[model samples]
Target: MARYIDAEKLKCSIDSETDSIFDWDMTIEELYYNLCKLIDDEPTADVQPVKRGTWENTNTPNQLRCSNCEIIHFIAQYPHGEINYCPNCGARMDGVLSE
Candidate 1:
């Protein structure tokens, strides 16, 4: 699978093989969920795993993106919010099995 790291400042840490970028308050699960959402909107529907990454902000951002599909999903999952994605196809989880 082709992989690419897109975040500018964050990439530096990865290249250096350091954990500096991981010390932020964000959880791995949250990052994973966000990654799925960002890549969910790709036009190709490739259903392949793609690489997308982001840096931590002092203030938690409003949205997180899927790594593969590039679809925007809400950071806060609330009463009327749903942010889910398919591991196989990177499809947006619209409160359904295959949304």
Candidate 2:
């Protein structure tokens, strides 16, 4: 299993004691890039995208209902079966996916 840290947590974990280290602030993208480099040093686990669809298909419906925190992940092969989860609040999609 991969361990995913929030952006804020990642920023605080950086070491600033090196001689060449500077205090120049970095944007979220830059921080994320550096964080990825650090995380890449170890055997990284899979970090699922914050969007819908699988790794192969990037064109799937991924909208979620904020009131319930439910998401339509992917339609299952079976008639009514589908893979869904609430990535935002981390809840299960118990309701049927809408078209």
Candidate 3:
């Protein structure tokens, strides 16, 4: 899964490595690739995982609501079990399977 990393922290890491690891033979491109690898090795908390939500039936027919953010959405029919994500909040709509 792809996730975000702290860009400022990554920049600091690159800056610190630039002076210590560079040599007369090491090209800038090599340094860039090395930094990319280093950043990939480190984990940073820049964003939370995708939020989870469950489908809740609404008063109106063929309408479902997100349990997490309470965003209502219209659908073709009831029993909206196929929907896996909330359009408004980008939450994974799977409380039953997740729990």
Best-fitting candidate, scored by TM-score: 3
- Stretches of candidate 3 above 4 Å error? 1-45, 77-82, 96-99
Residue pairs in candidate 3 whose N, alpha carbon or C atoms collide under 3 angstroms:
none
Candidate 3, position 23, lDDT = 71
* Colliding pairs, model 2: none
Better of 2 and 3 by TM-score: 3
lDDT of 3: 0.76
Ranking by TM-score: 3, 2, 1
Error of 2 at 22 (Å): 7.4
Candidate-wise lDDT, in order = 0.45, 0.45, 0.76
* Native-referenced Cα lDDT, model 2: 0.45
Please identify model 2 stretches exceeding 4 Å from their true place.
1-13, 16-23, 43-99
- Tell me the tens digit of each residue's lDDT in model 1 across 28-90: 986666545444422332345533333122233675554445445555654444345533345
Candidate achieving the largest lDDT: 3
Count clashes in each candidate, considering only residues at least 3 apart in sequence or on different chains. Answer: 12, 0, 0
TM-score of each: 0.22, 0.23, 0.46
